[model samples]
Target: MIRGVRGATTIEKDEPEIIFSEITKLVQEIVTANNIQPEDISSVVISTTTDIKSAFPAKAVRSLEGWQYVPTMCTHEIDVPGALPMCMRVLMHVNTEVHQKDIQHIYLNNAVSLRPDLVK
Candidate 1:
């Protein structure tokens, strides 16, 4: 079976290091809470709203756990009028037997308001 976890977060500022750190922490939480394994991850996709061009969120975590070879892609989100600025989102396709409801998705910082349904 396969499952997917979705997460989003916002940078408190435009700082590159801060953006990278926030993404690293959030990705770690999402993976741990869902009991995900590096090998179990099929693919990961990330998107940032225009204001967040500092770093690709995917690179922050993938490098930490030697997941550097994972299939990762980053792009820009749809720039709707009045959308959240400096936001980064991730969709992880995982090869797991867990049910969709059992997978714990994450939304951190200002982005936590984006998906009120899932949070700590």
Candidate 2:
């Protein structure tokens, strides 16, 4: 089955280094928690809030070891009044046997508040 693993994280600033670091952390946590191999991922879609423009998070994803061919795309999230800023979100589609209810969705940094019900 193909399962969608969701994740989100916040950065303190709009700097390239911070964006890269936090996004890398978020994806890594998602992979680790779900025991997914890079080859198992079909694609990854990342979106950032309007406030984030210093870097493309997809660059961080493609740089991962063994992930050179994993498809990835980046875009800006739909802006909403009072929504969280400096946030990066990821939806990773992977080939896995894990049931939907068993999949782990990672929310790190300030994004933990975005899905308080899902964080374990």
Candidate 3:
């Protein structure tokens, strides 16, 4: 079976390094907490707020982790009124034996408030 993990985070600014670090933290946290392996991750779908286009945040993963073989992509989040700005969200689909309810999700930074129940 395949399990999914979702995470959300906000960038302090549009700079590439900042976006890179923040996303790296977010992805690593979710992966580690769930005991997920790099090869087990089917793929990751990342979306950033309209305010962020400085760099491909997904590259953050490749540079910081041993997850180079895992497929990843980045896209723009749909612009909506009153939505969080300068934010990046990821939905990770993994090939795992874990059940959906057993998977862990992460929400950090200002995005933490988006799903208080999931923050650890």
* Tens-place lDDT digits, model 1, residues 8-55: 888878777987898887788889898887888888898899888867
Task: Supply the global lDDT for candidate 2.
Answer: 0.96
Better candidate by lDDT, 1 or 3: 3
Cα lDDT of model 2 by residue, 1-120, tens digit:
899999999999899999999999999999999999999999999999999998899999999999899999999999999999999999999999999999999999999999998999
Candidate 1: residue 31 Cα off by (Å): 0.7
Compare candidates 2 and 3 on TM-score and give the better one. Answer: 2
lDDT of 3 by residue, 1-120 (tens): 777899999988899989988999899889888898888889999999999999998888877557788889999988999999999999999888887877889988999988888776
TM-score for model 2?
0.98
Which regions in candidate 3 have their CA more than 4 angstroms from the true location? none
Clashing pairs in 1: none
Candidates' lDDT values, in order? 0.85, 0.96, 0.89
Clashes of 2: 0
Worst 10 residues of 3 by lDDT: 61-70
Off by over 4 Å in 2: none
